[model samples]
Target: MAEISREYMEQVAQMWNARGKGLITHMALEIENVSSEGVRVRMPFNPDFCVDKDQTLLHGGILTALLDSVFGLANFVTIKGISSMATLDLRVDYLRAARSRADVIVNAHCFRKTRHIAFNAGNIWFDGHEDAEIARGTASFALTRGDTSLLEAMTKGKAS
Candidate 1:
């Protein structure tokens, strides 16, 4: 992995938070760690994401969405000159039932990159149980490269 600056990581966090309204904002994700190698994020458990009346079991769809979002952040941190990116393909597996009120922790990284694409893999687990992964995912993204980076475009309010 290439070296990423602390300033750049801070900018990424700010950009993520400043996006204002969207699924990401609704997730209320926190950037626990960021590097050229990958990113780690925490999503607090929300009862609204539960499928049952008891609110113990999280909907699988929410877990999938979390992986997709974190994969994007992984790409953003690892790839350069990316003006935008779109998920070309995504595959997620539920290893175990997500039945806890604990915050979810996800670790994702861009494992490979080309001129126009990136591949990422990640896994998720509850806050304290690293031995038991609840979900795992792999995805590929179509990269749009340009002189203006995604970060710059977003910060300048020019990203769409």
Candidate 2:
């Protein structure tokens, strides 16, 4: 299989960032890396997403969404064309609390891909601590070809 070019992958990352709005935009999510093998993303700490009144801990849902997005990005990069995909299942294990003011780093790998399903695993950690992880997750996505619903929205017009 042909690999995606670095320039093209960078474009993909920018497109993904542009298409991200609402909660993702509000959370300041950024794509740090994209490749056929995996993807990396960073989400800066936001007091609005804090779970505690003191803003010392982040809510678990934020990490789950970030993991799902990163895993899905890994699957998308492997596809040759623009296709529609949905998360079929996601399992996340929380190992520790995410401290406030620290960016959340998520790295995901596409371990396996079949005709219709893509399997991925990911790890989430606070910046500056590679050995210490805040959470880890696995996800499966159902991919569809020739589905331009997203392609059209992303390329031609706004996505609903």
Candidate 3:
């Protein structure tokens, strides 16, 4: 494989929470560090992110999405600095309820990859420590090989 470029990574990382330019953006999810096998993502706490029935705690589904996306991103990072993979199996374990005031940092690593499958692992912590593991996850995905390219994937069959 060729060497991965910083431009490639920054462009791809921006895509992590970009649904489009104006409609939705997770600009709050900042990438602190990146390597070929792993990445670290940080999200600032906001009172608007409550999860319990009373909306006082962090929600499980949001945690799942954050962990899953980071793990899946590790898989894509192994590729040609582009993404053509989606999760097929995602299993998450909630170790403890997290605080809405707790800032989250998700660490995910690309452990292994086969010809068609990628394996990844992730840990979510509110305070970025082993003792703060509010959740942990393991996931698998099937990589899709293609020639159409991401540009087409982004603009095809959509209004200009």
Once fitted onto the true fold, the runs of candidate 2 whose alpha carbons sit more than 4 angstroms away are: 147-152, 158-160
Order candidates by lDDT, high to low: 1, 2, 3
Which tens-of-lDDT digit does each residue in 19-95 have in candidate 2? 76687678687888877667888888888888888997988998898888888777766665546789999999999
* Candidate closest to the true structure, highest TM-score: 1
Candidate 3: which stretches are off by over 4 Å? 18-27, 53-55, 81-83, 128-130, 151-160
The TM-score of candidate 3 is 0.78
Residue 42 of model 3 has an lDDT of 85
Better of 1 and 3 by lDDT: 1
lDDT top scorer: 1
Better of 2 and 3 by TM-score: 2
lDDT of 1 by residue, 59-146 (tens): 9999999999999988887776889899999999999999999999999999999999999999999999999999999999999998
How does each model score on lDDT?
A: 0.89, 0.80, 0.71
Clashes of each: 0, 0, 1
- For model 3, how does the per-residue alpha-carbon lDDT over 1-160 read when each residue is reduced to its tens digit? 6778766666666664563343124526777777785888887775556755666688787788787778766665556623367788989999987864767889998788776788889988876465768999999888766675443455463322
Ranked by TM-score, top first: 1, 2, 3
